[model samples]
Target: MKKLLSLFLMGLLVFVLAACTANENAGNETEQPDGEDTETAEKVLYLNNGQEPTSFDPPIGFDSVSWQALNNLMEGLTRLGKNHEPEAAIAENWDLSDDGKTYTFHIRENAKWSNGDDVTAGDFVFAWKRLLNPETGSPAAFLGYFIEGGEAFNNGEGSADDVAVKAVDEKTFEVTLISPQEYFLSVISNPAFFPVNEKVAAENPEWFAEAETFVGNGPFNLAEWEHDSHFIMEKNDQYWDAENVKLDKVHWAMVDDTNTEYQMFQAGDLDTSDVPADLSEQLFGEGKVEVVDQAGDYFYRFNVTKEPFQNENIRKAFAMAVDQQQIVDFVTKGQEKPAYGFVSYGFTDPSGNDFRETAGDLVKTDAEEAKKLLAQGMEEEGYDTLPEVTLTYSTSDAHKKIAETLQQMFKDNLGVEVQLANMEWNVFAEEQSALKFQLSRSSFLADYADPINFLENFQTGHSMNRTGWSNAEYDQLIQNAKNEADEAARYDMMYEAEKILMDEMPIIPIHFYNQVFMQNESVSGIVRHPVGYMELKWADKN
Candidate 1:
């Protein structure tokens, strides 16, 4: 299986993590039991989630904010271990057919959900079928398209009965794939593949909405969820491997501001926090910052259906105007690399070359070329003056600063004045998903370790492709890449697809992401997989 090292090795190789989760009235539960030293009775870690998790439902909580916490509270057939490779979790072991398109997983004999029900093979079948059901409306549904009939079912062209997954027996779960997926094991480690308890979910479809009803089968259990304020997780004694679990509890706060979070960290309320951009240099110079590697890019998308951006030349002009290098050096001021292509570094191709290096720079940055393109685009549209442009971003001091910098860059490089707008992450995410914004900042963390994971997002009508851009050829290339059994040929198709995406200019590359944060030295053993999300299972406080 491909390891998370495909995400690039910066410092620690262990998938390190820190505390997080919602707290309802678990306030009393976090208190120490009698006679134990109040300070030493329970090993508790407090951390921030930045904002409320979009949802707790396995398939529904697709974003990092939600998946990071869910990663601990729920167990998938496989889980990314401290080494960042998929290891057996609910499924004790699995076998692959000689064709490499079918997988049979063996469930653990002692595996039990938080509610004490067996983590059965039936649960996996039910959850996976739910994901492919067109009525579920899950954005993460596309991730499962590698499964046979998943695409047809999700696209409403087939029924759930057509999906090639089933419980062979109580302990045996089977899944057949449409093709040979290189990252199948790693991909299934994503929170979206976690099985939902069949009985609990059938009784209460809204079981994931609150702490009282959530029944997870991982290292931790949701003991309290007070919504936007905070949430709490207590260690699950029922976990199959609970004997090895370290942390007793985790408290996750939903504060979105980095500066405020840093202050709370300084005040000792938070065990860890993201380094404020202003303090990044100071912290790094003091040897206090940890540069966590991530396989993803922080970029911007242009809604091609919106005015001005509807012109390809205009979109390219705007994309070429902003210097990604300058933005990384001045605005983000971290250990991030400026992105020249959609895919970030460290994915080793079949021939053993980094995919990003192999693809080279697809995005352009020539100021003169940008100015000419802008003028030509305006002339072609017969506009006496270009339409007013607004750059939208979510609520983050970092996002705001980057937007301001981009606005200024447009003014200086192309002589185009642009307005800036910001909204809370939820509102911004919803608006962007609905194609309500012309130009907006966006980030993508690889759901799995593969170049195709990054390149597949621009396909026509894909949930990730909110830009309203469509190219039949590009879509076909992605489809071909997915089905191609030869790794070399598959990668070549992905390379071509990326080039086509850049040529269309529906998006601008900013910088590749790295999780730059500070963790108190006293905390240890948190596992943060580079594919995406953190695992608090092995975390310990002193």
Candidate 2:
């Protein structure tokens, strides 16, 4: 199989920022209650992070900081644009062979890493191949499924030599694809495709986590990281595209308490933080806070390998009882959109066709119908009574409320008693990976603006596919889509695959996530990605 190239024109870099500034009125700053005097501010942005990042390495890391830091420091052949589409970064121009199986990239000669090392095509060749290497255990290997022999290589079913990644010259890279992939260039923008210095990573296994050893080609470098206290990233002067990079420094602090984070923002101790469910109205009154509504999804995945869940009727009954709109309104305080599909609503194809609508309709809410389905499933399984199952969620107050709502919905509608388990976020992740829980929360922010990025993760044996789901028909549908040449035909196949999943009821769609934040009026330049997380480069303190 040869690697395929789909041409995507690069968009000009646009640094969008919020212009609002947090200036203290004299009446508020002093007891005298004077009318006008206030002081100017410096460019410093403080953010409140809910989870402390576990690692900084792209392969082993899985958290906000890990991805955010990489996005700021390391430049990939392609990058995520403001529109969340793939745009050229290090590769100024590229070409696809007439066969549509070979991609030849021409690296920009002026590109350099933070260490002043020349950015070359060889770096990408190493990076892509290294990710497919079994020993690397990159959680990101799922993103490489489109490359020639990539899936087989990751599964240990093929030799690493079979994977088609080659460097034609210092500036030119030739990658062969097994099939033409519509999202191939968009995949390149993902961190899984970001280049790493082979010489450095090989010599120092602990390079990325250490400040001094960290080598990056992006706009900023890891200046300092203190586990629970704070981490800092300073601007990298040697970055290839440094001219457009702004902000001298970024201070990232981990604040687990939503109230504390809100207070920090209110007191001007922090420039930006997510608004807690309690304080949204108070902060919204000031006209400084804004919401980025089209991002992420909050849903629970049921591990189908579990006996009762293995029965499709049981899963369908469970999904049909819950009203996602109510969940969004009551639990998320109406800050989010109800999710009708697995992939987010804002996601689209290259031609700008919305996948959320194209993917078949999700399970409808019908309590009376749910009861009949539950009874039928139990009878078919020859069970005298309903089986007991547990739905697990995080210990956060918001999560608890949602879980309780779901539990009540199931009980009242289906007449089944469900055990609700709440644990800390870390514990929940560990248990989910271990398959310790029958049902668990599994939300995703699309790594790229493609349905393939979300859909492919659920194929059998993938790490993120913790539900122990396996289906020959589902797998074949994905393969057929990948091999299908016509764009419309391929998408139709994808839509069919999603429809099959919905019919099978393997997972429940809860709500499309909305990133809600309450920042002080004084803060400025804060921008949000539909993928979640704030991009600080464009941020400034007014």
Candidate 3:
């Protein structure tokens, strides 16, 4: 398998090299000596995606609609830049109290929703209070765990209004934290933190949850959304930052099949989509395609509280047993790199080669050794034969194929019979969040470019920590790292916490995801940020 992967990767490298040369030649072919504009037609853009969004409400399902809808309909305290750092959005400037527990934000005075209402700090206050409301059942409420008294509030043990957020005035907001957090700004940029119009939402309680009910302060508004179909967003002329907004409109279509999207791009129906697996090489240097290694990771989570996987030895054995290279080559078609550690490569470290290299050693792959470990774990559990484990995944053929491949790998290596269960994407998400699955594959899009965003998920009480894995020692280390003012000391603490997770083996690192988009050469101003969101505000159809 290793040899095959090496050969395939080598071939892919050659193909990519040829593509790069071709692209360079094309650039030279189209070069205008100097001070020349190769401008073309303008303003409208067509976007293609796979899987229709399950909901437009940020507090509900996690889907493309939930993300794309917010781009035009709401504004958060901050927005992530291409580098994954927080930049000004509704809040223009912010300051942290010396103790790092209090944050004050100065709102952009001119910001307004599509309804023409001036955006006030009160709106953010109301939105956050509503998010922590136990009645609201906001799935991402765990994001508020950093806020003072948030956990208590979310648990229905305290009042929502008392959850550490206050509006000092229309243009100013203050947030008190339970403890100091290094990635507080990044967390604030998340969709769950986006501010909504309290009055409008109350008048039309169901509106905020529906496609047409949204009125945002974003660069675009939800013009139209067809369930299980496509969604359309039109430029918000009322956007406070409209002068910088470029695209007149954007059409987003959910398309799951890579070949289907490829065909759409070929027919000029889609401006861009992920490159198809079979045609990666042909499209590599073709003036119209763009591919980059994205800063994200895809991993499999084994529910630590569930049967079979509840055993630590089984978890560790599974983590060390799977061959990540094979999956990268066969499943993603050489689009992604094998992830050796939790943090993906390309993310710079404050001081070190990278977080992965700085903090740890990669898990060694040894099938025989893994089998021995599994047997020992089973014996320790007083079971002669391992219980039949069910690994769940989404309904897509690719996801199912990946799940089956993993099942077969375990069976072949460890003499364990594994079953595969597939569910629709949305259903799978609900099941995972509810701790209703034994094992599932998940992909994490970095909310920020820090190791904290990814590592925090495994912490106890984290909303996204569906596996039910937590260690008091690990949690303490994270909290200590946050409280530490010394940068080096903080990083060391973080590394120590990461080592705990690595040893726990609750998560099996697969590959760091890579983003691939196919577009026409004429499509300009499309920037791919590390967080995987396209800031269509500056996108130009020309």
Candidate 4:
């Protein structure tokens, strides 16, 4: 009996020991790092960018899409905030001269580029000079022309060294302007003023085109780029404020078709996508759409250098024939407001009055009056019948709808046959820049909140003025506005400039844009500036 009791005790001891060991192993497997669960997935944001970026190089990127990506990958001396106010980015603080003609910026010592290079004042000097270099052919070079001697250098009449930008020290950058610009701070927030690493750009001209060579000082860095499909950006560990950057990674998918992007958003593939015009109403009603009042305008420019468009009466007649209200209501589904002037609504003058309201409606649609004007124009041009006009737009379902609507309107109202053409975004942009189309669709988002931002584009020799229209009186008014110190006087001069622009009819205003996009409920903190660009630094994926 003593031997049997001893065997049973030994067996029980072994069984208890095995059970404890199994429990210990299970506990070890369940243990997490830092006392947090290990199963938590990585935070990521998936966005459909709508079109491929033209260039990530700051000086060359002038379009909205390119600016969107560049705004993430690069940091300027200042950044635009929610209300289009200038906020510090690389420059910790700045000083403006009493006359406001000079600005001195103190670079942040903690700022570091993705490649570990210290971002310095010299980078700003080099970037400004490079942009002003005529050989660069930067479309945004005009943005730099506000600086003293900038225009002269870009015109190839002055030496680059004569440009008024200089580095006082490794951390101090100075810029001298031609005159006191009220919106100078806001203007520098544009990507055109972003600094570039001199060493990287000198070594690789195609640095921005590839992931290996691209280095930026923003909150994110390029990780992988699959041409025409997508690109991924990982959080930049070296960013000055990386701790506050909630997203670990961002994936931008290039899906040009709005319907495809919407489908992707529905399928859980895209966290955010551009809302198609047809679906905007439905989405808004469902509380799935974000409507932003953008400081921009959607319009079509007439190539005044081209045959029939060269006639002022022809341009005015066509401009008056189109019913802007109908297009905005039916085509954009009332998402946008009919624009009668070049400057968009929402911008307030110094007197606290809306600029658009001050500048009233410059043009109005009257089908009967339009027919009379067209008859008179045809008589003046000594043509029995108007020539068939071709209108061009970028490839997108919304653009196609707008183009078709306009085509039908011209045919029905004026008895003029119209042809339509469409091309990829990049191709269309290039063709428009080269002035290769008779009539082409275009839009301009304000670089700043000032009326000069819109009025300056139509200046006599401005690169953005693809219509080949020029008037000395209009140019004088813009110059006067720049030099006018009194706020009321400055506004008066700008209003006159806009009047001239409307009378010339180089471009017909369609509607003022309201940013209509959709985002998943879980995605939050994606900052959309009043100027219509997305800031994703504070964005979080829940």
Candidate 5:
């Protein structure tokens, strides 16, 4: 919320050309009939996952680490194409009812999983029901609430049979939505909507737990997994368009530290790595880093049930104490714009205006005002001395640096000495989601290219709302937007909801997420979607 402060620290979609083949068989070994040496080399791409995937089960792996890999290992009815728009994948095409609430998809007859099982429309019905099944407790269930009766089923108010998804035939999948959604096609491209192998799952409930048991219909198949260490994906020759998948293997390492990952890249162990904050200046100066637009936010959440943060005024005070411009300029140094609002800059409204631009700044920087609010909050709590505050973050060199910067900023602006604590990502994520932290780091990558996707996270009981934050008016506004048929009216509802979310101060806006990385010259065709995910169908390495 603080727009400017003393520089204390520190920080696209990038479209690479698609390479059709490898470089002169660099790793080949063979003797031609004429005594010429010749052989083919494996086109392997090495990447760092930054952490272990939350889960391989499509519905359960809702975060970046898992979705990044899942996107390659599975396909939904529709998938994001190289242009960052949804295109037919497993479902060759679909017919939308004139009223627009019902959709009938025609699955490709040749689509097959790695195990050679034909992908059927029933798989979609099974996966969708599993996602909305209250017993499954899928965190991404909210993403499917667009479907008619989806919310009711997930809320335990209705049976799975109540959900409006059905396998009309072996190849026909039909779904009825609560209302017409402009982003439905794009949203389904998310991993939460990926179809599961119902046959494999029925025989082995834990089919997704190990490489041997895993099955995928995407461009790659899980070949090896070592839990927290690394995993490998080999090209799935059974894929519908396997000929287009250029990479032979994808090796993913769970390295949380960017500096270490960068070192690995320099050592040729990885093909690409995040530009470390310390080296951002150098890498950027050398023009090795490419910054691409992404739709999402990087922020911190306040657990409302926790002391100090329990007071709305105190939450606002803490938020106002942050100098986001300082964080991006010196700390992150990734050329990201400081975020003063919840929604990222993208989504064009029916009026043809950027949602973020039209919404304008929701909060401002005022050192005096922040201090006044802190005092008033303390008075409201009748505290002789405010309770201690702890700022928590998951393990990451960059996150730790940002947390430290926040610590100094709070001290400078509000005279609050906030302690710092951290844990590995998996543990930190679980604890935070359970509301075990007073204040912790959080991020939101758009599930679709729409403003509502950014605004829906704070709804009263949404799984993404880990801050113990609940606002009835905000929730109603979101619900109204979801049901509103008028495009102009829907945009208005989202704007109002976002404003209220910022006013309540359950979260502090830091900087919007972006596709900022340094890639190898030898690697190409790895498309980074503006929706903040990678497309490696055509990725290749020499």
Candidate 6:
């Protein structure tokens, strides 16, 4: 009986071991509800886009927020890379003429628009002509001025046929430049140069305003646009390199308030958001902040064509009254450098010296001089006291703080009563563009790593020159610099132009911008170019 019990126990032990092994194997083979064997789920990247994009039509969209969304939705001949260098996009390769004034691009056969239409060379020709057409009213039409005959066409001296872009074949596109611009390739990567589908645009001028009608040719397609709340973009299966794209979707929330956006980020509702200035110190201490030296300037422009501001003394007085050091140190929390000039510090001259350092301290605060100038300006305008002027800024905590500080400085040092006004980004941009305000906040991010980009805005009739301030000498200097072959001569001409700009004071230099933002550790492969562009084509949430 004892021997029989021992055999039974041994059999039971073997059976128990077999059952446990079978259960372990079954658990390892478990599948998702959809029967997919993948261990991870589809990834979606979330971000606070800062503001509602004014427009998605590439030619009409000029602000950073608009360009950010457009960059994901469209593909130009080239695209900005990690170092802000030009990388081939729709154009597979190109051949430069021996004279360096012409480029012949070979379009990729696999490139297709979101609607499954092949992106032909004719599309580029049509787009270039459309951008230069005065009737289009694209603020960025000046971007095409580098192409041969572009300026003449834009100025109504020539017809669209006179423009030097041509399509030799369905796959071959060519462009002739009026001059050899070293940064031409880099400039074309901007959204203004992206191709537009002639059929779609002609059929409906408002196509880009709606997600369903917007046909893009980039890594993502606009799936939904909820005006002030958020927008959703999904992977574009038709993109040429779609196979390599990592994230399945991207959600851009339009959150203007930095504090609220940061709160959402902390709650894992956002993958990235700009850090509020007040919280930068704490975030940096916690090793959660990323700072990048930006090639941009934050400044305010005077309506040079309008009352009071028409007098250069008033503009100069306002420029000198505000203490830039205080704004940078206290308001910005030392995240930015005090800008005494329009051009930021990241750019370098041909000799490798910093541009800002080269053009040192063109403007600075002087309470006494500012007071005297204010009195003189009012006296010239035939008023014992200065009239109440309104200062306008976009809706943001940082901007509000800066505007309030400037208001206080003007009242204290110059005895000027300045009213503060705040508007949403879209409205504020329109107000500035229409010259609807006395003084307004503005900023310029480098389109390319050249001082010319900063100075080009003030050219006569330039759309961005909202100040209506024109100087023939300034225009001529820029032209001379463009034509100059000697590096030293070009830089010398630029410096001279900058001096004239500073002395005239069409815009008040506030501070040079530094990119201050936060990103979660789970996000990877995001690219922030020094030129103030963010690219997320390769970003993954794993």
Global lDDT scores for all candidate models:
0.88, 0.72, 0.75, 0.85, 0.88, 0.85
Candidate 3 on 188-229: residue-level lDDT in tens? 877878887878887887775545577778888776666778
Q: What TM-score, computed on C-alpha atoms, does each candidate reach? A: 0.94, 0.86, 0.87, 0.92, 0.93, 0.92
Top TM-score: which candidate number?
1
Model 3, runs deviating above 4 Å: 1-42, 61-65, 82-84, 95-101, 178-182, 285-289, 346-350
- Judged by lDDT against the true structure, how good is candidate 3? 0.75
User: What would the per-residue lDDT of candidate 1 be over residues 1-542, giving only the tens digit for each residue?
Assistant: 23333222211211122223323433544444554443355677889999999999988888999988999999898988888888888888999999999999999999999989999999999999998788998998999999999999999999899999999999999999998777899999898999999999989999999999999999999988888888888899899999988888787989989999999888667889998888888999999999878999999999999999999999999999989999888889998999999989988888999999999999868899999999999999998899999999998888999999999999999999999999988888999999999999999999988888898899999989889999999999999999999999999999999999999989999999988889978799987777779988888886
After the best TM-score superposition of candidate 1, give how far the Cα of residue 308 lies from its true spot, in angstroms: 0.7
lDDT of 4 by residue, 1-542 (tens): 97555435533543353344342112323333563322133466888777788889988888888888789888899987755588998999999988878899999999999999999999999999999999999999988888889999999999899899999999999999998887888888888889999888889878899776799999998876768877777788899889989887677889888889989887667888877777777887888777778889899999999868888888888899898999988887747899999998877887999999989999999878878888888888888978778999999888888889988888788888899999998889889988899999999998878888899999987999999999999999998888788999898899999999999899989999887787878789888876757788889976
Q: Estimate the TM-score for candidate 2.
A: 0.86
Stretches of candidate 2 above 4 Å error? 1-42, 62-65, 281-288, 293-295, 347-353, 358-360, 520-527
TM-score of model number 6: 0.92
Residue 277's lDDT in candidate 6: 78
Q: Cα deviation in Å at residue 160, candidate 4?
A: 0.7
Against the true structure, candidate 4 reaches a TM-score of 0.92
Give per-model CA RMSD.
6.8, 10.2, 9.8, 10.4, 8.0, 9.9
Which is the winner by lDDT between candidate 2 and candidate 3?
3
Cα lDDT tens digits for candidate 5, 273-295: 99999899999999999888999
Model 2: residue 205 alpha-carbon error in angstroms: 1.1
Backbone clashes for every candidate come to: 14, 10, 4, 0, 9, 0
Error of 5 at 409 (Å): 0.7
